[model samples]
Target chain A: MSLETLSENRSFGGTQGVYRHKSQATGTDMTFGLFMPELAEHARVPVLWYLSGLTCTHENAMTKAAAQQLCADAGIAIVFPDTSPRGDDVADDEAYDLGKGAGFYVNATQDPWKPHFQMWHYIVHELPELLGDNFAVDRDRMGITGHSMGGHGALTIAMTHPERYKSVSAFAPIANPTESDWGRKQLGAYLGSDESAWRAHDSTVLMTEKGYPGEILIDQGSSDQFLDLLKPESLAHAMMARRQSGQFRMQPGYDHSYFFVQTFMNDHVMWHTERLI
Target chain B: MSLETLSENRSFGGTQGVYRHKSQATGTDMTFGLFMPELAEHARVPVLWYLSGLTCTHENAMTKAAAQQLCADAGIAIVFPDTSPRGDDVADDEAYDLGKGAGFYVNATQDPWKPHFQMWHYIVHELPELLGDNFAVDRDRMGITGHSMGGHGALTIAMTHPERYKSVSAFAPIANPTESDWGRKQLGAYLGSDESAWRAHDSTVLMTEKGYPGEILIDQGSSDQFLDLLKPESLAHAMMARRQSGQFRMQPGYDHSYFFVQTFMNDHVMWHTERLI
Candidate 1:
């Protein structure tokens, strides 16, 4: 429950704080970066949680997204958590997408990973609870957004717990991880061979089964290398089948990289702010 | 002088291009990232050259600085060159500061570094030539900025060739390297023990010797761990002695890190835009 202030600096007329806390779920110290707007002095601000993708830590979203200015303008606080629990003792995979950098925002039930890879619990329960207690965040006005796999995490998490998130969006998210190679490999290893369980975490399936009341905004790049694996069409089909009010837009000549994310990040922050307000 | 386009993507309603070229200076394939605003289609835009500090490649500023939106808003293009030349044939030192990451933005006269450490020629001359030929950048309207050691680069380069740079700024820059441990170590190794020759690259000394007609803007964090080494007062004194209009602000409770850079980056972009326009 104790948090260590690793580093704190003032940026863009806002305060950026990096904190480390021993996670009860992961059994390791986890680090996250938060940007609190200057407006926080007047009243509690809406919170936006950003999940990063493969080969990324909390630092990626914190540094690269270029989201703070818009968040500051919109009077929103942003939190960035490590992609996964990491330590010399913590288990890791040689592959970039399976281990330390790839939490996939799922509660792993598999061996070696079950103990420290409870990212679902970390993001949804532990992180929000911690932020609410320490920072002046409007818990009821929380929103979520992310890049790539983190996009998938935001979509799935928000869809599953609509009451917990007032808004949700993604940048080049893996729409149907249940059908993608990354999804099949990660979900199989983390949740076992049960295809039924995978559906619970697949944003497309979640959209069809339990429609989100609020609009689900997604931006996918046409040039993204992972387009074959992301399959945004599946989510589009699911939304249409369910008569979902969410909007899924495919951006032209973009990729599944930070360049794409940074380009559209302000719009995402603005979108979340509109809903949070 | 054929450039190989490594990657290109659209985001935040702009184009991010990564390119590599076999440098006649560094004698290796050097990489740089450029962000072109949508406004470039209609008119040639002012350019901001961002030089990174120690242990950073072009990737650091490209991924971490979060300057693209501000650049886009200001209708400015950002060019980030790799910190130093790197290849199997390139000479290197075990220390992070000296060998690969420490080009020092000077034409090295020493043996091992002389051949491949031509960052001065690369950035000041060759880069502008290439940008003029290949990109929609107004060569006549350009500005420079950097962080830490790169701050030193921005100041020295702009002052030395005021014709090339219309404005200049830095974030937690090492104001007077001649008086700092990092600068002395790098200068001694790269430029030899000739203390007089070092003045050409020392911003404070350059300000006193060759006064800049325009104002210089700098933001230094009061809590920066390297404040003792940075010596902002030395630079301030030199600027004052020369009667140069410079804005040197010491921000309270900040540090010499990217968090500090991202916080005030918009101001730098806006500063350059004002001068460029």
Candidate 2:
């Protein structure tokens, strides 16, 4: 697919750019942020995918994550896909939690959303191909991470496609979305009342049932306003029940904002870089 | 004056807080971002003031500048002041370069802006006192830096109050605003037609007339669209004519954006911290 360069800026010794492309999976014009480190100019580098939380465009993590310096040092290229498909014609709900910016990184099976909310196929399949074909990215050494809703996407996507991403991590992720109110409402709307269908997209359920071979890293803020809805503890319990290796850290005095994400961004980038290398 | 804590978040082992208080100089409620390094709780740490460019709120640098981690490591408390006074009651112009978001960091001596555009007094006098009284900041060990219009403000303010700020630097600053269109338009409206008043606010003119003590650092991006209007070379020439110690660097691929500011933010913070220590 042909991509349009929306804007580009020199940031942290890298080219931080935004691009627009016609996506087959989403059936819409999708935009994503791509940051190419100076090292990418000379050789292919390990690529990391960052999915943003609800109500965020590609700009949120691009502007707020503070990950470029670390990624530059690690010689990694990071791509940030928008949370959901956007545009006037796309089906959107008035509430922020259900539509537009809240794709939940799943292929919708319901009407009004199924037509344009195939973010699962978009991020997992189409986006990586587009980046590999157009940019200096090594498809073999890919890693994935995100915050909140995007975190759910990261875990489930990584769990289901272990061969695609070498490392996986998240910040304040909605671990057991099938059990939480946020997850129930979104899953109910998009996947209908079939509880079993929701289990495939739920990280906690995926971990207990499918079990990831690699250790998954997660950072949960104790002060997150949506901590109850996130239910990170449930994921920990599931990992323990399955005897799966996972690292879950509860950060004190932090919240469910970019401020929290940026504080530990260095650690996440380095974690992925070490594994990718 | 009592300050209302608008919001606070933990960032980079520091508290990134926004506060609002009634300002006597601007005759309005002014808000500023205060990043209190963890060291500040134990000691009165050195303070660094960051003035943003035109059409930016204090939040721009807070989110985009990516300076917190560096500042935190350097044990410096950074404060970001809004570009101009804002509110419904305050006087404003439709044009972005004038009125509300473009206070020019000077005391307005003309109509429509005189009452609430006294950013000069607000930054130099009232802001320092407020920070000192409300936070753990060392008034004697302070530094100032900015970008574009804010860079002009930093140069002039630091030049005039050399005893207050220990070090000064700017990124893509309008060095000789009096000689540039943006400067001429803003200075004319704020300081009236008296060209003499404009000289004090122009860094090039000020350096030539009253040379700054110690060294000043400036970084100008070669690809900056407003390079002609900024005239960093003019200031370099004036500094040389006066035998003033100033270092001016032209970055090759950078532009006039927060990306450029964040690129060199570490160098600037370390530069200021070295002098402060």
Model 1's TM-score against the true structure:
0.51
lDDT of 1 by residue, B178-265 (tens): 9889799888888889888888989989987886767687777767788778877677556533445555556656788899999989
Worst 10 residues of 2 chain A by lDDT: A239-248
User: Global lDDT of each model?
Assistant: 0.86, 0.88
> What does chain B score (TM) in every candidate?
0.98, 0.98
TM-score of chain A of 1: 0.98
Q: What TM-score should be assigned to candidate 2?
A: 0.51
My TM-score estimates for the predictions, one after another, are: 0.51, 0.51
Report the C-alpha lDDT of model 2 over A73-127, residue by residue, as the tens digit: 9999999999999888889888899989999999999988889999999999999
Clash list (residue pairs), candidate 1:
A11-B263, A12-B263, A263-B11, A263-B12, A264-B12
lDDT of 2: 0.88
Interface RMSD of 2: 26.4
Once model 1 is optimally superposed onto the true structure by TM-score, how far is the C-alpha of residue B154 displaced, in angstroms?
Answer: 54
